[model samples]
Target: MKILVYNLKMNLDDTIYDLKKVTSKKIGVSERDFASFKIVKESIDARKKPHINIVYSVMVETDRKIRIPSKGDIRVLEDVLKKPFVYGSIKIRERPVVIGSGPAGLFASLILAQNGYKPLLLERGECVEKRTQIVNSFWAGGKLDEETNVQFGEGGAGTFSDGKLTTRINDKRSEMVLEEFYKSGAPEEILYKAKPHIGTDVLKKVVCNMRKRIIDLGGEVRFNAKVTDFLIKDGKIEGVKVNNYEEIHSQVVVLAIGHSARDTFEVLYNRGVKFVQKPFSIGVRIEHPQELINYAMYGDAAKHPRLGAADYQIFKKFSKRTVYSFCMCPGGVVVGAASEPETVLTNGMSEFARDRENANSALVVSVGPEDFENSHPLAGVEFQRRWERLAFQCGGRNYAAPVQRLGDFINGRVTRKLGSVKPSYTGKTEFSDLNYCLPPYVTDLLKKSIAFFDAKINGFGIEDAVLTGVETRTSSPVRILRDDNLEALDIRGLYPAGEGAGYAGGIVSAAVDGIRIAEKIMETYSNESL
Candidate 1:
């Protein structure tokens, strides 16, 4: 019988040399009682501050009957094996096309390829290797490759992020996504950690390995292949026109274009694909000293090596809007994440070690269709562009981001000089009043939210903290309408998946949505037909 144990607590300084011995002792059994033990879940219990404890849920294989605790933490381990996916009988004439090589496209292609369906994965930007070099050059004062910057690459915008895999979703496919990532060079700890993240340094290798596996499984990947237009016949996707020249015909198309693909969204809207304006957030990247954040989160236990770096998520509600901290990167830097020319946006990223001197996050206010100037589906895009252009102008139209000190920003004054916390933006930064770019409501809420957040995490509103302008791309501005079968509404054979489709948020959810889309496609079309 396999017994599941929960709430097994250990001190940070305790050495976990043997799992079997530990499990047996916790369950009041001898070491020879359990045949094997596996950690089901691991999390840190730091609510008590300096007395932090490592909590574990373990599954133990034991033949002997053990006394189960009445604390409701232990129960019988139910091992339910999932049934295999049964392929459909409908025949497919051409290979299924997966647009964009981000998490959604990659996972969708992986699923199709593993089922013997050769999928053509298309990406507008370069692969991870070249994309990294291109992004580095752009950060180092070189020209930004509009087609292949931080947003359009093989791994999507997430490639240059902190690679956080945590999501507010509960799906079995989430495990599948994590498993695939683990198989593709991610650290093993990501499999069990409470909040797992594959830093930018390690994520590149993982994405590259996943791409290679897709290719090895009879899938074709093409870089710099931008889908300029959709070839439709009778409101059904017949193919896609690449770069406005080459047309690749395929009945089935997975529209996994990421959130930053504004042009693609416009093209789809013009092609009569149904869309609706959706809500997204916009704000600035706020930076603070890493030590400050650590001391705030860990209290007196800030120097514990077990707690590598501390991260935080905070939010507050207002009368008209809700302000929150999104994409908190511990010991990370603010980055220039511009895809369009002459526009400046800020994002945050961290390496695997997370040993940087500063921490940052997006302090944003919520915006919806009501906030947009018009009711048009693309209104949010225009709303974002307006502020991005304003930010560009504020920074002298030189691609430099506008930055301000927290004190000056709260006081409604332009920061002429930086303070204790320096800006870690990869690109150039110019001191400017953030009020010149952001909406009045947003700036007002941000000012108030900082004070509220400072109450939660001490020093959050430190005078020296840096605020980098214009983080508009928080999520998709529009949602491509889809039917019950995950196909585009009123358009057969067109599956709109991932963040671009507005069906998911973050990396894990996006990948899970992609897997679900692939499953729908497989259930509709037979792999043997290919």
Candidate 2:
């Protein structure tokens, strides 16, 4: 008999000498009755503070029949396996093309290649190997490559982020996404942890491995090949032109371009692709001491060796706006994410170890179409650009990020001296009034949110906490309208997927969206011939 167990708790210092014995004891059975034991999920329960417990859900196989207590956490194992994908019979003459190399595009192409679709994946930036070098040089104050900075790269903007895999969407495809990541150089812990993260350092290798697998399966990947134009005949995508030349013909095109592709968005809008302004958040990156956050979260167990760095998410609701903490990196640094020249923005990234001294997250407020000057579909883009340009100017127009102390920002005064916490931004930073770069309404709400957050996290609003300006790319400001079939509303064979299309929000969700899109394409066209 196979049995599943839940809510098994152990103290921080407790060590299991024999796992089979533990399971037998928990379920009121003998060790000899156990056939196999496996942990299904594990998480730290710090809600009790000083007395932290490790909670686990495990699956066990028993050699003999056992009577489970009717009210206990044990139950009969009834796992439902996912159904296999079925390919369609309609044959096509040309292979499918996937735009961008982010999580969505990569996974979408992987699905297509595995099923013999032989997709052509295109990226606007250099490959990961060279993209890493360029990003490092830019961090070291070298020239920024507008074509391939942190935003536009082989792995997309997510390559330089904290690489969090947590998402709010409840879909079965999510498990498939995690399995793929694990098979492609990601840590094993990601398979079962409550909140899994690959980190930027490890994620780069994972992405590269996935790309290689797609190629080995007979798919093609091209870097530094920006799609300049989309060929459409009577609202059906026929192909795409690369770099203002080199036309690649394909009947089906997946637009998985990431969120930072402003120029591509403009071209698509001009070409009459349906678009709608979407609500997104914008604000500055807040930095605080990692130790401070740990103490607040873990109390007396802050320094326990078993416990790693701590992370948090807090949000407050207002009458007309909502302020929240986003992309919280426990032990991470702020990074420059500028895809265009003369613009400045901030993002957060952490390594696998997460051993940095300070933690950072985006503290932003929500903005909608009503906030824009006009009802134009691209108004949000213009709104973001306006503040980004102002932030650039405030940072001395040299790629430096504008920063202010939390107290100074609250009091509406210019910060003069450094505090206990220092800014961990990768590029140059300038001390300036963040208010000047942000809208007056946003600044007002942010000031109020600090106190509300400080009450919950203890030192969240400490005087020394650094606030870096401006983080506008919380999500795509423009959502490319799509039909129930996941195709562009009017453009047949033009499928929009991932963050750039406003379909997904994070790495996992975007990858899941990509998988769904690939499945839809397979269902419509047969891969036996092309």
Clashes of 2: 0
lDDT of 2 at 189: 83
Residue-by-residue lDDT tens digits, candidate 2, 290-368: 9999998999899898789999999999999999999999899999988788899999999988999999999999999
* TM-score against native, each model: 0.98, 0.98
Look at candidate 1 and give me any clashing residue pairs: none
Tens-place lDDT per residue, model 1, 261-343, is 99999999999999999999999999999999888888888898988889999999988788999999999999999899888
* Clash number for each model: 0, 0
Q: Which stretches of candidate 2 lie over 4 Å from their true place?
A: 16-20, 69-71, 79-84
User: Where is the poorest 10-residue window by lDDT in model 1?
Assistant: 14-23
